[model samples]
Target chain A: MSVLEGINSKALKTGDLPPPSPSPNTFRIYSMRFCPAAQRALIYASVKKIPSEVININLQQKPDWYFTKNYKGQVPTLEHAEGKKLVIESAVIPEYLDDIFPETKILPSDPYEKVQQKLLLERLSDQLTPAFGRVFRAIKNPEELKEKFESILKAFEEAESLLEGAFYSGTSSPGFVDYLIYPSFQRVYWLTFLLEIFPLPSDNFPGPGYPKLSQWFKAITAIPEVAAASQSTENGVGSCKEYMKGLPYFDYGL
Target chain B: MSVLEGINSKALKTGDLPPPSPSPNTFRIYSMRFCPAAQRALIYASVKKIPSEVININLQQKPDWYFTKNYKGQVPTLEHAEGKKLVIESAVIPEYLDDIFPETKILPSDPYEKVQQKLLLERLSDQLTPAFGRVFRAIKNPEELKEKFESILKAFEEAESLLEGAFYSGTSSPGFVDYLIYPSFQRVYWLTFLLEIFPLPSDNFPGPGYPKLSQWFKAITAIPEVAAASQSTENGVGSCKEYMKGLPYFDYGL
Candidate 1:
């Protein structure tokens, strides 16, 4: 069978690929290098010790191969061992990785813990993503934009405080919640620092309002894996400003 | 123990509670009666044979208790046995149910099958909740409104087609995926049919575009557990239109 076929087939479990010796199947990741969603898949793959062939995609003009694999044309689609296939959306892919690799234990095992993890992750996706995406898009009047920044900072401050008592819920290392949420958090901070948009008149970041969060950001950047993930030239604040400029409908008042 | 204490303590175990005992210690569903999100919690409690106390929330007024339980103030907060507390987004609750009641086996046991199941459920949440939500809210829009409807219908049709040849792929009974997704589907159809928004010069309700989906809707609704969970209401589409009108800024281009 072909490599893609192996990926799309049932021959490979998510975490455990059949030994490369006999069939020597390879895993492939189709995504844009800097895309946060794509990075989620890559992060899991990296932690899982799985090597993947990364295909960086262009949003404006998608390649035919991408369309064949995923009609939706979104990034972070995966071709597994048997080539059975899965496509589109970042959050779902990481969950699939958790499913396949029970040994890795990226997701929590206890049902309630699992549920808590899932909900927290979803909040990151739903609340945090939408809020930041909206901010990045900068869709409101100046006063309105200022108000939103305050609101987002308030929410972020809460999350930062939540992280205070525990490295991860009192554990020594970052587990499911930390891994799932940190990429986006890092992205936000990088943008904020790069853009020099911190300490919004309404709400302050990198200040007393977000002391725990500010500290956590410092701690996260110290991690080698996180440092490696970022190649963004823009400082934390500059990235924030540049992110807004890159939005498709930046002028439309989201 | 008090209601709030039980949730935080994580004491609610599935079989630990003696087969649906009467109130206080029994299950209580804190939900908004009409919210699609709250429906997920209700449906699972119904399916798993867990008894719950129902708390009605008025989204407009913003209940104080709701804020206390969930800092975010969202409904579908579950207060269960043993002082176990869970408060987060709607999409995360079912996994909680499945975890406690392994016998019901709402999700698949095989690792690969689990991956497929998780992926499907997440996709359902994305397609049904936000993506379709945008379209449903735009019923009053002209060009943008039509575009939204087309996209929703397309998603519905695609999802319907994917479920061919099975009650569900991973399990014998309607497991997590079925129960999780059906509520949204149920609400969507009811809304469309009630509103007379169909045949809107853009698409047909159960037309060739969504024939398979129409069939699945009929089958899922017929299932006793799902059927019992639904409160037959005035047409959903009309109700949705009315709901939208009441909102401050829901004008569709004439």
Candidate 2:
């Protein structure tokens, strides 16, 4: 189908083919790999087994196109195949993946479960993300780092209390919540291990600690797709420390 | 079917039902009538005739439970239902509304359009929201106010260019994008007129110039339920000017 025909005929899902006249402009994922926001879309694409070319942006020195696409100059600007068909925001992009590849069904099928999944995912995105960002930023200050880690741990405890079982709500299979939590947990591990703020202590949850949550995390990460998406120890050592180095307020005890 | 049976049956669409509990907790919405985020769930519930009780939250001394339910302490929180569910975040709440009232069919029937709707709504939430928020915050600084107003106008121009006619995309009347844009635009009007940003002056999308959008706004406001839910004009005038009264940043050499 022609590109315009695809859009006009409501073939956005079926029209997965790259657009014609696609120069260097085809399917650029404007992203910074270290950014969690960027990682959400990229990692989901990786899991969905879609090949997306990256445009690794120097977020500090944003390009003009980047400004044109997203005035805020946020990463993970997805330029769709058709000219000027841009999808910005990480949480938003995953829905597109879910749309085009309905069979994979990363999201839950039932609507109530869907609500649960969205809420769980958004909680991680909005609440936990900002908190995690703060903790990582304050890693240089032992006291501040300790407080931040405690807050996360407490938040985890609250989450654990709400969980039905190994997974958050329904079953063994990791759905929306798993995707949201996995990336953040990966970052948290790096913070604990490399920064040595709270130490990689016991895997306790739901029994005076979150042992179930620890096990759940282990199970989700063990999935071949999730395992591949995760960072290796060497990669972790480099990237986490590098992010710490670049922040302007690194030494201010944030 | 019984509420418990229906909930257990996993048949409800997201945001379709009043939520299942042995006893239905009466819902009260503490919200500003113009806020789009609040409108998402409100409009849905209103169309469903869900019969929710309302309490206008005085923004200055916001009640305690509002903080407890939402740490960010933003509004349109629906309390007293389904075991005290504190649904935070605009995107999540809208999905919840859809779950409860699938019959309203505010979302597009096609899966692709649904996903497109999700992405479009999210972009509107993220991009437009902050731009609107920034304008509201910079109301005190007339110079900064003008710059931010220009930014808002730029966003509106982009919206105008993208939209074909009647609505954003699809032939369906007032689907996702319509619900998403309506409440936010209501807010833009409140900020622009009462705060004196006057988008009518813009060379590009002079508010009056976009007849379709202007008419659409009028139609949406004309909805009796929407009009009833809206805030008092005098309150808007008092608060907006009071918020801007002391700050020189808005005195942008006009």
Best by lDDT: 2
Model 1 whole-model lDDT (C-alpha atoms): 0.58
How much lDDT does candidate 2 score? 0.59
The sequence of per-residue lDDT tens digits that candidate 2 reaches over residues B2-48 is: 11111112111223333333246555554544355766666656655
**Candidate 1 — which residues are off by over 4 angstroms?**
A1-25, A124-128, A138-152, A166-169, A196-209, A232-254, B1-25, B124-152, B166-173, B200-211, B233-254
lDDT digits (tens) for residues A89-143 of candidate 2: 7777776668667887687766656766777776655556776778877877887
Docking quality tier of model 2: acceptable
